[model samples]
Target: MKQLKILVIDDEKLIRWSLEKHLSAKGYQAIGAESGEEGIKIFEQNHPEIVLVDNKLPGIQGLEVIKKIKSLDEEAVIVFMTAYGSIETAVEAMKSGATEYINKPFAFEEVEVILDNIKNKLKIIKEIQVLKRQQKDIVTFDHIIGESVQFKQIVHLARKIARTKTTTILLLGESGTGKDMFAHAIHNDSTRHDKPFITINCSSLPETLLESELFGHEKGAFTDAKQMKKGLFELAEGGTVFLDEIGEINAATQIKLLGVLENRVVRRIGGTQSIPVDIRIIAATNRDLKRAIDDKSFREDLYYRLKVFQIILPPLRERRDDIPLIANHFITHYNSQFQKNVSHLNEGVRAMFLEYNWPGNIRELRNVIERAVILETMTSLQPDNLPNEMIGKIEQADNSSKENYTQGNIGTSGSIVEFNIPNEGFSLYEIEKQLIIHALKKSDNNQTRTSKMLGISRDTLRYKMKKYKL
Candidate 1:
């Protein structure tokens, strides 16, 4: 066992001697001082882990001593021993940084219990600090926060793939499902963060200029070509180029991209020379690439090439277990940005957030929190600050499903349920089943329309269908 060091300070010789004897007998190295001034000097020299100071002391008061000790070592634990009928003084002692405010004439057993509690707390804090330090080594997982088993499995998979030089990684998910964030994580975690990470929105850009923008245009290549320009591929040499909305690329553009992917070279439009390039490719699509391939809207060969390392990000609704963590993360970020001291979410707000299907996925949730933080005061964010559309839904849910409703949408019957168990409670399966059934009933069972209304991955809905024996 580790040796415990304690400093006992009091003007009364009997009290100081008694404490020293009892603590020493309890296997502690005890130091006694007659006054607060002497106690401070003894503490400075001894560097004791714990201090027991009398509230009434000669020269300096116990609270002042605690403040001084705090200024010197913020982690130092000080227990203020005050006489009876000084409850107010004890509270003041606590506010001044004393670890515990105990009445004088207390029994040794009570003091011993308090010391044990403090020791346990300190042990937990030390473990937590060590864990935090270990986390500093992690670069990508910091942004992806979740205690859910599924999310953890995803992180585990991502970390393994990130260490490799995989060229094609197709991130499939719904819009606002954090595909872009995961793309950034993959790029940063990979061996190519030092190089440029160029992103192209195939759906956003015009097809006419997409080729030139991707492969560059030479001087006098076209009407607006005043000077030579490097395309995203050339600029991303020895790095990664993220093609978002890859499903939106036309067949012609797809053929061109296929050539670049296959040959690792690009020819500037209106230029004869083929420029050799070295770059990794990461593409994302909210659209079903397989469906596009089946429809002949996308090339099957290119689809195979992009699927070398496919990662499907679950929509926010699919991973409802992650909502609390994600919500807290956004709340922290918004609180800091908006300069609000708001530290916690009300139970009602949390309940509503978890219950609602985030159609926009993570993006939608982040936007809602950001908006609420900006618009609402430091006081509890009432349901009003939420999206106006959601308010109606929440109201309806509240009315019909008296258990589930917090004044939102058309509440379906039997929507409200509580879960509690010894250590283990409700399974994610049960909650998700209930939510889906409610959403379907609410949306009249239109799968496509229901998916949009629920803000969940269609794949997730299908998977649940099979899981629930639908």
Candidate 2:
């Protein structure tokens, strides 16, 4: 936090001394100047938070000083002091950008009141600036860049439900598929846009703590419960409560949550009274809740209640057409963030992105782009800028398509593998699995050599092996 600095400019030494003394005692860093010209020089050097100027001064008037200060910094707060008590002069001072005008021979209490009001106004302006930044920083639906048919349908459905009075919404997706971002977009577009939007991860805390965090607790409810506290449900009021990792909550908590969803009310852990809450519950999870229900971990009734408005996000692999759009969006984002002029990805780099399976989804792509932008020196994103895993995938794709490639397999005027399209069709997965096996056998089951030969990262190779049960 910065110290509040006040510049007191008065031709009378006694007035300047008195104000400086009083302000300094009140924790303000106050400076004194004998003339308008001197005050302006001090202001230019120190940039005080508040300026106090006497109307009648040598060389320049207080109104002129306020205009000069305002010109230097438009947001400068200025106080005009005058014993002349001329309403016209006060109006002129205000027009010249003096924040407040004080008549001289006034009590210190009056001056204090004015100063307090000015401080409050400045605090409010600062808070509004922070709030505006936060609101703009939110990942709204507009920020979700997608163009594939699957991606478009999901976004379209989400937008429709966002404006509805839906009590419960369940967002299902793999990890890093923007489930939380969707929740934010829904709340921002809803009727409770101006209200608080609180979010909590269900799996972050233990069951006891999690329950207390959601519904709050009465005073002395636990060893650490010293004061009566409001939970996220009560705090949100008519806003929204986003429960991420909804599948991770235990069955007991699920029942309580279901009751809340079914009755629009929540009860504190130690309190018997059911408090009515008008908040929307937006639950998201990367886990397979349907499977959890079959395993008797998640409540079936709770699942249905939360599934009133369901949204299933398509993974990046399923929306290959949107990869370029998303990648370009990340390029633009990183360009601004890293202060680099990354205009676009090169043709080969774009091909690699399109061919590679983004198992980590958008978040993985974002991290890749961020790293590349920081490392890349040229304006365009080139092959060298991509992660090794993606580079390996590029190699794998090239090896599969190129002719006369004889790294391990020997064939004349033909590639390592050849395939004929059957009328019944071919399985791409089987083709990929066979390629991995061939590489492994050629390397004598050496993972590192196999990864290098196949042109994929070792980690990716291992993941593929597990995926194919090799």
Candidate 3:
């Protein structure tokens, strides 16, 4: 470590000499100056790490010298020394940027301790600055990769609304369309960035547990109620709470949630008093909430309240232009995460990715890339790296009009094979089995190509293969 240099400026010759001697004995490079002007000159020449100036000086006052030194180097540590009955001046010095103030006739031990404390504080401040710089430099937008106009517009809207204090946000989109990713991004960019972001899938939890999970429960609230526990709302205090699969919440839970939204308060189960809470809410659902209200499954007032800032994410097929960006993002992401050097996707792979209707949206794309990265041996991901469903859709152009196959088939898989005219109709399972075999043949038994040609998940295709004893 570099030796600390301390400059002492005082009109008293004895005081300056004594302080200089004491500091030097303690392993500090101490310099003494008779006047504030001389101190500044020495300070400019030596650029001392710390400055100690007396309140009374010949020309410039102690506080003025401190200001000039600070103007030159704001990080330079400074301490003001004052005689008795002039503590008011010392306080004014502190407000003027003095790191510390010391009274006259200061004890050598006290001075040493104060200097040590200043050094430690400066070290901590430096460390905090470095950490903040690193955090600021890191890229947080790695997950939501897209360049299409529709995708760009959605991202832009999310950013704008994130700055607002809107308590409720409704994210409407089909399953796997990256609604959760956008919700997280909004929370990260909002004022609650430093606070907790609690996410709960309404459909994943049972009704009884869902109520307790969202709004806490007092002791003895239910048969198995062991102790009091905070719920999602209280846990996410001063932050945001994300409700995924909002449509799946039943009417009872809906009523309770509505109370929280309207009153900004929640009562624990079996508790009489309601406690105020501060929480922003973001709700996501694939179902049409308005229609659900009409059906009496959801409350109309809650629906309108949650729609304060609405964001409707388009499906992957609707934003076809973003395929390459999304694919390349996945390639880069999985490469680092999986420790694979997989570089790019081949032309055939890219075509299949764009042509296939991603019913699962971005979620399906991520899974595809993850699988490809794990199974791929070559530097580039070829068409075979994808699932059978994706490949099947790419090659099913001629047979597109079949009722069994829609533009975006959820899990349907089929193929063309001339079969003998049968007297009885074939079972759904039989027809499905025939389609898989024909797709496999058309792709020359290449599972990747066959899976793409079949428009089914590779796992599904494999399961069917074993089922048919192929």
Which segments of candidate 2 are over 4 A away from where they belong? 1-5, 17-31, 35-47, 54-75, 78-128, 393-470
Poorly placed runs, candidate 1 (over 4 Å): 1-139, 396-470
**Model 1 lDDT vs. the true structure?**
0.82
Q: Rank the candidates by lDDT, best first.
A: 2, 3, 1
Of the two candidates 2 and 3, the one with more favorable lDDT, higher being better, is 2
Give per-residue CA lDDT, model 3, range 1-470, as digits (tens): 46789999999999889999999998899999999999999999999989999989999999999998888888879989999779789889988899998888888887888899998997898889998996664334445787766778888888888887655899999998888888888888888888888899999988999999998899999988899988989999989999999999988898898899889999999899899988899999999988998899888988988998899999888776577678888889899988998988876576667667788898898899999998898999977778887777766852553444332242433324444435664555666677788778888888878876765545445656876877
Residues 307-334 of candidate 1 have per-residue lDDT tens digits of 8888988888778767867877988889
Q: Residue 294 of candidate 3: its Cα lDDT?
A: 86
Ten contiguous residues minimizing lDDT sum, candidate 3: 406-415
- All-Cα superposition RMSD per candidate: 18.3, 10.2, 14.3
